[model samples]
Target: MIVDSPKIKNLIMSYLEEKKGKPFELAVDAGCGTGRSTRTLAPYFQKVVGIDVSESQLSVARKCTSHENISYQISPAEELPLEDASVDLINAGLAAHWFNPEKFGQEAARVLKHGGCLALYCFSLVFEIEYKDKSEELTAAFNEALLILLEFHKKVVCEVKAMYQELFSAIPFKDKQRISGICEVFPLTVPEIMSFLQAICSYKEFLEQDKDKATAFLQDLEKRFLDILGESASDALGFHVYYFCLLASKS
Candidate 1:
């Protein structure tokens, strides 16, 4: 599951710099999976720690991550292992919805230094393909296929769909802001998009329910996408994603 959030990170950095100046000492990537977001914070912070409950994910992160300042720990978001008031930034990238927000907020407040920043962000599953003649048809078909996955989606996904309102309210920081409709476009092929679909929790559950049917559903979706584009699976397609972010500062 690739969670791309460079834009959000840049925005967080700008906010931090405006509030606390440059060279942030430490950044904590809460519930970081495979450390993808952790690596993004490496350039902005002197040290970055990725905390997760999955040892398997951390093992992969340890092997794949090359940044000298990046480290992975098997820890939960609600209970961090760091010292009190030691972290400058805390980022929960697409993983905040799965956490116990009240407990996690307490931990965030406990670990964050005065004026430290907390950023929580998540992207939507609905993607837009902007082909002049076929855009609407393509989006309709894709969304129709996506409905099956949504039906099987977990509660956390529903929380994300609600834009993490409860989670945002649970944040201990008094100074907070929420931004929505942050769109990002990426060039991807039909196969690449299917790979992303396969990574979703709902898709995984669907697969477990009936692998053959799940496989066939994705295959059909890909075929429909290719048919609409009038291109091969290898042909590049534009995918527009919308994300929402919540920023809070400890005072």
Candidate 2:
């Protein structure tokens, strides 16, 4: 989802361009789950390193990624392996909510060179759908169904839903800023949308709590979405997802 997003890529590029300095040599993707964000950084930086605490995720990333300038490592966000003042950019995509913000901030400050950039971003679920006459009703139903799933969300998910207010506040950088209401429209099928929701960690945890209820909720959601589309499960649907970003620069 993060890699296939053009808006996100443009946003990252625009942020880097706004800094307007020497080209970045090394970019660090902190808490990079499967190297999606790491690959996104490859074209912009001389070398991109993806760091995650999960060995399984790193193994998957190594297997899936073919970029010569990108590498995957097993490391925690609070204690990165990079040298101080070595990295030119540090990005945490959809993963900052899980980090100890203060420790990660200190580590980021240590690793990033003067005038380096730091970006933390995450996107919400498909909050709105663009169909014919049923857009409003479908969106309302989607929100209602999402509220049920959110009941089992982890604390970190709540932090993200709050637009990373706490995480932004923890960043010690004086040049920090927040950008919100960045929306992306994706053309996907009803089943595809449901699959995206199932991929979410919070939804997975919710499924673990009550598999029957979770299954029913997903089934109902799929049905509702399809019904609004007036087409089969394979029919294409347009979904709008909203995102927020926190950007900072080392002085």
Candidate 3:
């Protein structure tokens, strides 16, 4: 399982705690894919339920998760299976962009208790790498490759690029704020970076359209990156990801 950034987890939990107070009773990880973000909520909330539309994803989530307080469920972000006004927090990490805004808003309003909080967050798709003096060169290559992938997933790419400003604005909660430029750095090699990029939904979609072409495209992009990094291709580089978030409270 992918180890999610503790920095991002801490930021989300701390910010929610600040607004709603600690020892939250129930928190839902809406659209929790493979329970990566859901597991992060365990310590802060008494019970953390991970809800996703895909049972296959939920199966992986259940297998990857061991937190006694965490549970998995199959549900949609626009329509939760929980009781009305029963949740303290609803968090969607890298998943809200796919949800129907109006339906999700109503569902959130229905499930959240008075003053309950909703947190939606995702990292920038294109990450920057700091490798000796070749940081800018590698970053440019990544952006170039991302543009190639963008053609296959233009809508998702555009929404993320805008930092989900439209979704954030559509949240019915008047008491809400959008935060941007939260940077988190991780150690990852060039190959690891390539693997991460390929795991994106856009790339997977591209792969489904033409397997050989997609495979060749990714290989070519990896070659370009390796060429740019030289000897540092095998060495772990500082992968810097910027996170944008929307935090809101139910009235």
Model 3 stretches astray by more than 4 angstroms: 1-5
Which ranges in model 2 have alpha carbons more than 4 Å from their true place?
A: 1-4, 124-126
Judged by whole-model lDDT over C-alpha atoms, candidate 1 comes out at: 0.85
Give the per-residue lDDT of model 2 (tens digit) for 1-251.
32436676677678776773668799999989888788878888899999999999998899889899998888999999989999888988888888998998899889988888898988855479766677797778778877777777758667977888888888888999998888888886677778878977878998998999889989988887777666544656668888888999888
lDDT of each: 0.85, 0.82, 0.85
List model 3 lDDT by residue over 1-251, tens digit each.
Answer: 13566666776677766777765999999999898889878888899999999999999999999899999889889889999999999999989889888889889989998878998888767578788899898888888887888788888888898988788767888898888888888888877888887888889998999999999988998899888877767888888888888889987
- What is the overall TM-score of model 2 with all chains considered together? 0.93
Candidate 2 or 1, higher lDDT: 1
In angstroms, what RMSD does candidate 2 have relative to the true structure? 1.8
* C-alpha lDDT (0 to 100) for residue 1 of candidate 3: 17
Instruction: Name the 10 consecutive residues with the lowest summed lDDT in model 2.
Output: 1-10
The local lDDT score (0 to 100) that residue 77 gets in candidate 2 is 93
> Judged by lDDT against the true structure, how good is candidate 3?
0.85
